[model samples]
Target: MVLASALLATLGLVSPVSAGASKGVELGASDTEGVTTSATPLRGTRGVSSYEGTGVPSDVTAYGAQRVPAGHRIEGYSSPTGDDFGTQSIIGADGRVRVDPTTSFPARATVLITRTVSGVERLHCTGWMFGASLVLTAGHCVFNQSTGWYTGQLRFYPGANGTTYPYGSCTAATLRSNTGWTVDGSPDADYGGASLNCSIGNTTGWYGAYWTTASLNGTSTTIQGYPGDKSQQQWIHSDQVRASNSLRLYYDNDTVGGNSGSSVHTVRADGSSGCSGRCSLAFHAYGVGSGTHNSGPRITESRFNLVIGWR
Candidate 1:
């Protein structure tokens, strides 16, 4: 739920308990620091998923098993149209509950981001591991398109739940995103990744991404992130997909500001040998088109192939 229009100052250095955050601060990436990133558009067909996996992971250890069916769709959050999509209830507010440090595959893969804006401000966002050294997140979290500058120092805390940092923290060595996001601030192209200076993924492992042209309308989806409203602790929510186009997937999940770049995934039986039960589906980006309901850029062929190239 980043309010890029708010024109807030950028921030740096994340605290375990909302230590460096300001009151009345807007939730989203600040228009502060960011270095220009150079990336070529991954050459591939748009709107068509062209990954190598079975699309549905057979044996992912990310979650248990699939809970919903395909073609699952719902209305936007608090939509004036109707309540057919279901309502959002606070599962936890103080960031005390709804944490998943124990069943720690997806949660373990999730990471918290701290950025310094304009040399003085500090902002927070979320990301998840996609490679031994690559952490995926929202492009704006790394490059502030509004200011045409990249973030100044970027720090990542992996498997961070509450005050504990299970796998330690690392500074970003490199940040990457699509050329579109870097130039025009296209929300449809908001995905980004960070190459860390450490090997935290070797210990925690990373989730494998899957993409397909098949409908994800009814498949259950889960989103995980460290929201500013929840004291910047890791929060998890499980829900079903409401709609999907080539660019995005819509769902009703509890999300707030600071959740930009959170991973959108499907948990269930992947049926693959040694598979955990999860598949990477999308990357969360907050904005107007996203509205009140939780939505993200659906993992397309280009994004999938690019991420695989990182490995």
Candidate 2:
């Protein structure tokens, strides 16, 4: 009874999702070629081993993020929670729990993104490893409708602990997004990704994604990645799908700036048809201001195939 009693607390489920459409999209997604199963995580190899910010990368100097300075965090509101953590009003009393060993499964697969501006680098957005050299993130993370693609302004750290470079870091070989966001600036299409120069996914593994023409309203979703308030430390929260529109998903899983691009995923049992394990349902992109629920671009058949082709 003790373990059972502790279950809910351990899960730290998020508040109820707001009511909305529940219909799904057949994403025509991944397999031997579709979903790539996560692998056994490797220990921190970039710097010396320690529980916290002990591992060091050659290029990084700061170990933790500042209190998310204004103009530093996000580019703009409802753009992508990647850049700002202006106040707890956005995250809702911080319902997130920290993941101790950053080297665990999907935690190791999640990524910390840093973007440089005006000669300074800061915590930017969250990312999910979807291929050996590919990391999928928010559309705004790599492209700005006003200024244009961030090109060389971003750096990626997989399984990055507060100050550690457990998986080292990698830069983009190519930054990619669809015309929906790049040209149209659609929030429902606010998703993008990077093809890294290194094949880190071979060791860190990657997330599996799928889509279907069914309702996703009740499927439990967990959002875990680097949060701004906790410095560069990884944190997590969970909730069921609040609603799923043709191009986006809404949920109550608390998130803020620096949490953008985090995977909104569900754990499916092994041997499931198309996707199993840590199967991602959508990209976490916004907070409450985006219409009563945190939301992000939901993968569709074309979107899934497009991203997979990039991988």
**TM-score of each model, paired residue for residue:** 0.65, 0.73
Quickly count the clashes in candidate 2: 10
Clash tally, candidates in order: 36, 10
Residue-level lDDT for 90 in candidate 2: 50
lDDT of 1 by residue, 1-311 (tens): 12221223234343322321222121111111111121222232122111122122222222221122222221112324322221233323322235755236767777777775455424378888775678889888888866654544777766665555556567777788878789777877888888877666655556655666678888887888776555446777777788788888877766766778888877544343212345667888863323445577888654665655554
Q: What is the C-alpha lDDT profile of model 2 across 1-311, one tens digit per residue?
A: 21332353356642111111111112213333333322222111100000112232333223221222222332222323333455532545556788867776778788999987897778899999886678999898889899999999898888877666567777888999989999999999899999987766666678888766577899999999877677677889988898888799988888867899998988876556447778888888887663478889997655765676686
Q: Candidate 1 — which residues are off by over 4 angstroms?
A: 1-97, 100-103, 118-123, 149-151, 272-276, 287-292
56, model 1: CA deviation in Å? Answer: 28
TM-score of 2: 0.73
